[model samples]
Target: MKHENAKYLRPQHLSGLELVRDICCGNLEGGSVGSTEVTLTPGKIKAGNHTADPQTAGSVGLLLQVSLPCALYADGPSELCLKGGTNADMAPQIDYTIKVFKPIVEKFGVHFNCDLRMRGYYPKGGGEVVAKVSPVSELSPVNMTERGTISKIYGRSFVAGVLPYKLAKDMATTATRVIRREIKDLYINIHTLQEKDMACGSGNGIIIIAESSTGCIFAGSALGKKGVYPDKVGFEAAEMLLRNIRHNGCVDEFLQDQLILFMALANGISRIRTGPVTLHTKTAIHVAEQLTQAKFTVTKADDENASNDTYIIECQGVGVTNPHF
Candidate 1:
């Protein structure tokens, strides 16, 4: 007697199995992994040939929906191992790496029996992939100094992570332009957040060497979430220094305090007017007042507006044998 007609799997059933196998093997390219617009549709299968095991047959007709997480990396496609999934009220779990996808997997090969340390969780997604990246190259050394003459170097820094690249570049450019315009024969260097990691604020400093006839002044302005413009602040500071050098007048009171301290160290009597003092005639009157308590006798030039109204207060102190003519 011939055996009863054996059951044969149909084309449709074979196709369904192939589809599931393809997804499991990562054979299908869902979409651009980094694209925010891409989405994936789950596969479904219809009922077909049945076997004694209802479990395998029962799953044949059910639809399997696999939703993927959005890719966030901007660089190239990254290899990720899905840890596990959460089913509504189910607690989170991890997924073991069985096999890796091809091309990428072919190059990197498969990694089994590997431990994935979860540092943080991507909410809702059950599975997580950890990748080991290559180390970055070492940074080159940099040396900063004032060339020949004393230079006032000012630097303003912003958090690079917080600001866009273009905005940071623009801020640096604006600051340099303002500094060069205010100070003649001045050199300005502007660095970005990547260059300097100081907190977001502007700084102004001046440097003067005894050998150099002129002093160098610098002002740095920075862009912050909120505050005055750093470029303008730097400009104001440089301009203030320039005005002091040109007019021989006290543009900022801070300089007066510095002058007093500096001259005291040299044991040279220095006079800075507390009230409104011009570069014209009355500057001598101001210097005479400062010398009243001191032993040195103050003398003023008799000629009016002599040598651009520069009044030299001759301090006849013990160490100061010759007065500053």
Candidate 2:
């Protein structure tokens, strides 16, 4: 019902449960979640622009995550605009969500796009993000296990507000250096951005995206915090991406859970090989099972010839239909 992370990002006076209650049930006369028991009545969802302001520097990425499913089933196209932290600690970055996450969802026959109007960091929190989601009548099953060949590696480094452009460049340089050691012929390009008009205040970070010949794109990113060196941020981001690459997973660690809900909603069985199963993945499976009549199985492959044990997630979908039959 409540979590430490939720407590940190939510308004200090409002509990996470209370916030959800207010949003879903609407607060009448300042009544809290406990004031009344509201039953959710299902109906044909409307298509239009929906917006929210988290009030805290909460990750807009997370907000989008919860909204995506509902949007996908809307009677018509839906658009969402969220104002909050576009990039924050322990949350998915807008770049990764756009480049890596959305593409994976597309494989399930869901079409959507994310556009970041302005970057938002912590403290000042003034970022804006817009998402356009197209309704889907059905979802397709996926069976991805190969990572294919390394084709190109590129990155984007951004510094907002008062940060120097050199910080972004340095982070890209450091990250490229570490990644080059793994694949000598790999081409690493880094784009540096120093924008004075950051909607969400000041911050610096880098995101490295690896594109494979099979069209699978994986990403790793690091956000700049007080006292952290730019070079270190680059190195860490590079290392994270490299680790994911070495694992030979079709989907990166952070993406495994994100794909689960779609897989469970698909029309047929879906399977994928990924890195070690994370608690987040398990939790997603649990939630998916509860939401739909879907079944999930996780298996760990033990092969003496393989460097690391791989995780396999298999899902039998509930065949959820769009526009509600």
Local accuracy of candidate 2 as per-residue lDDT tens digits, 58-100: 7778777877877777777888887678878898988889889
* TM-scores, one per candidate: 0.29, 0.88
lDDT of predicted model 2: 0.78
lDDT of 1 at 215: 29
What ranges in model 1 sit over 4 Å off? 1-171, 182-187, 194-231, 248-253, 265-325
Any residue pairs clashing in model 1, and if so which?
A: 83-95, 83-127, 83-128, 84-127, 221-230, 222-230
Segments of candidate 2 deviating more than 4 angstroms: 1-9, 12-44, 302-306
The sequence of per-residue lDDT tens digits that candidate 1 reaches over residues 1-325 is 0111134443223333333333333232323222223222433221121111111111111111111111111122222232322111111112101111111111211122323432112122222233322211111111111113334444433333233455445555655565567555655554455412321222221111111123222211222324545455434534543443432322122222222211222233433222123343244334433633323232333443232423333332222111211
